[model samples]
Target: MVAFTNFAIAALAGYAAAHPGEKHDAHKMKRELVARDNAAQLGARSLASCSNSASSQALKARSIKRRANAVKNIRQKRGIKAPARKDKRTLEDLQKWEAVNHNMSGTYNYDMFTSIEEVFSGNTSCILAPEITNGPYYVVGEKMRSNVKEALYCDGIDLFLEVQYIDTNTCEPIPAVAVDIWNCNATGTYSGIATEGNYATGGYNSTYLRGIQLTDGDGVVSFETIFPGHYGGRAVHTHLLSHNNAQVMPNGTISVWNSPVSHIGQLFWPEDLRAEVEATYPYNTNTVALTTNDEDMWSILSADASFDPIPQWVYLGDDISDGLFAWIQIGINGSADYTEDEYYGVAAYLDAEGGHSTGYTIGGGGNGTGNGTTPSGTPSGSLSSALPSSSSA
Candidate 1:
């Protein structure tokens, strides 16, 4: 009842401030997620306590070097002269050079590339509680892989994503945690489910733009993907789910049936970046009306002083078309568990035959006992039986 009320309020608010082509309806209500409902549901060390720690300093230095090297590589590839290196760099100088050479006007501020204080400090302090509904399109037991981009029917600027997980209770990195991420392609359609408005090349059998990766010793996981496109009534975003003690099946999917979900949240990009990217090909071709961050209820509610859900990013080269490198720290309650969450009832889990279906119509609804079959009408055999699971450790 409370969730419905929140949805009602958000829907009303969204209607009052609808954008030029946005339609507020049942589809809009699906995004009414309130992740931050109470204090116990959140945890993260105060910035002042660890902002200057040795670990943080090392992280900041490594991040800076990684971005600088990326920029240098792009320049080298394009036959552009490399900028002179400096022992100490200033934001003003960086911005001037980027503006003159990269045409970064109307895009994200140059400071976001250099002054990544938010990235270094990390916003992982705000853990997403289990009670919050995962996004409407979330599928369990996705393939375990770093490259989520299948390029089947999607095209846009490349996005190399790196995510670091931190335990809120100890303010320390938590390695070996399974992180699941999925998003729509440049045309605003998701894979792994038979949904309306999806591309002909996408459906229950397709796994594009959806995959999982385990964090390394540093609690980091990287992905090669394309920037996500927007849909009606929602801002551009990516959905994420974290699992603790989840095992990998023989067919390379996660064992979500028994694993406890530790966190469920969405990551957002700066509007400036989104606007510039959307102006490009394929993305600009999307017919859905653009939804700004301020107008989206999730974006509005996710904003708080303790954490910044947006990732810190850098352009791969002098132009937005060259692609991007983005990173963020996500905070999670390492001990919390939501194995019985109601949202899991509709998950399209994996079968031994490499099929994913829950007998439900996916984006639509029905009884959960239909014959398991791929979108191509191939019988997937009986439901998946328990299989051996793998671990990062």
Candidate 2:
């Protein structure tokens, strides 16, 4: 018995020396085994008392998973300071952006829009794409051509404009819609006109950045154009007018700006994108002062707001130099069942259309309403009221 005691004491000392942090010694373990266990039976109570129990780890794991599930449930239901899905996504948010897939640095995306808890109070709705004054730059009865890249001195940035039209009430894609789009060249000059800021194009009258196209079966009108230069008062934007049931003329001309319009609005470049375009080429050399969206008093997406029906823009391309595809969702009130090549008027009939005749050929007075800056080097808050012309195309 004395030898056994001495042996036990020596083992305990060795264990202490090896494991300073361990509170349990060999004697304590032996005592526990002898005091509690019946060699034939192990009780559940004894297992529960163990320090490194599997049950304890499992309990902690379950608790963490439960908390995670609770958080996910709250988010799904939008019960917290999260905006309901209905608040942000209307029936028209089905327009999937298909483009070159540019990396959007500091840009807006669908994820960010839906994640925000508060619905933006501003006028970004599919119900109504805002319409502003056609501005002073619209060329009355401009040619319905695609290649508007005429200005040689213009430092050009390629732009692919995509617009998706949706039925306002049904939120369905409205097919066979005709759209007319126009903007200025890099030097703040417009095509098919002879005016101020147009001196770079020499003495000849020209039209550089203006064209028209009809929507495909998906209710989309895609344009191949260049990034417009900012001029006197307005920020960078594209003006568009849409006509449902509008006819596509044989020569590729669609006369619909004078027709009963289904939708009219503008597409905007993100302010950051603007800074980039302005830094290069003709944009950098433009004499017109730069303008911003806030300064332009252009709050509404207005008019050609496409299928998704908001100011959100998707720029597709790996690099800005390779050009980018920009998209907008527009809403229009029309019939889904209504299928016909809609005619605004015969294009041939408007062959003689010219002279201050009002269609969308605005600008000459430069009243602060444009996709560019005003001539006076000051921000003009908004476009001037479109003066009504008695003449028709």
Candidate 3:
């Protein structure tokens, strides 16, 4: 009886030791399963949040696109035709009407109209010239001649131009014209600002870095300046092209003078620069950044079909350290007679680094008031009074 009792006790102890390890393993596995489930729930929630934000952004973009399309339709309904070439005239002939009118008035506030030196501060000095060309190539001549320069800054970039040509019919290119370029410094602040009866003066008294150049035969123009910085509410861009002209005849005969024909437009940076700029502000909130080759409000409205894939007439190059340089082409059509083909006018091209390029229409032949006004509230007919022409290369 004693030996039987001993054997029973020993067997019970052995079994107890072996089962404890198995129980511990089961507890560990249960904890792991609970952790995994929690992680999955968190991941799903994050994904849902991202999806909602993207949907909201897409809706906003679609709304803007619809509005732009509506504007295009309205212009078409107005019987606006594209511009084409007709006659040619000398600079004196083009200026004849202005000489006679002498009463011709334009915006001349210290804020809007300043000298070239005031526009380009902290940059080098340079000059751009214009030449003449033929066919679609004439657009290049216009751009090459315009002494407009693009500057990049922290707040935003500025494009300074003396002149630009906008076809009244199709809102396309008008060649063989000069444009003056100028803008604020790197901080997106313009020159000649007055505060508390004290004027804020920095660079040249006459709009710094501002200069004029004529369009080439191919309707191209060029400029010398620095890379502009990005500002709030807009991407990195420039302000340029205040005055532009359109030729009605090939022999320099009948010409339409659109003085102070404000052409306000801007150039955007590449994806890399855009990303950096958006990180700054209001732009950061924009979800469109996710998409490649995104277009802004101005781009969709002013872009032309011919400017696609980059215009051959446009060119861009720079020393990087010293300063930047750019060239654009403008083509003017519809001098002799307005035709459907001529109504569309010509396309301008731009060439920049990284193979990035874009184009916009030149001559939209519509007689409308531009944005610039004199200090006395008199409207200026200068091309600079409206949206300036733009190119990205």
TM-score of each: 0.71, 0.52, 0.32
| List of clashing residue pairs for candidate 1 | 124-331, 248-390
Best by lDDT: 1
Compute the lDDT of residue 350 as modeled in candidate 3.
17
Better of 1 and 3 by lDDT: 1
RMSD of each: 8.0, 30.0, 30.5
lDDT of 2 by residue, 155-243 (tens): 58876555666554544456777666777777776554444444425322344566666677656666768887766556677767665
lDDT per prediction? 0.57, 0.43, 0.27
Count the clashes in each prediction. 2, 40, 152
Winning model by TM-score: 1
Ranked by TM-score from best down, the candidates are: 1, 2, 3
Worst 10 residues of 3 by lDDT: 125-134
Scored by Cα lDDT, where does model 3 land? 0.27
Better of 2 and 3 by TM-score: 2
User: 147-197 in candidate 1: lDDT tens per residue?
Assistant: 887747658988877788776665567777788888888878877765444
| Cα lDDT for residue 252, candidate 3 | 28
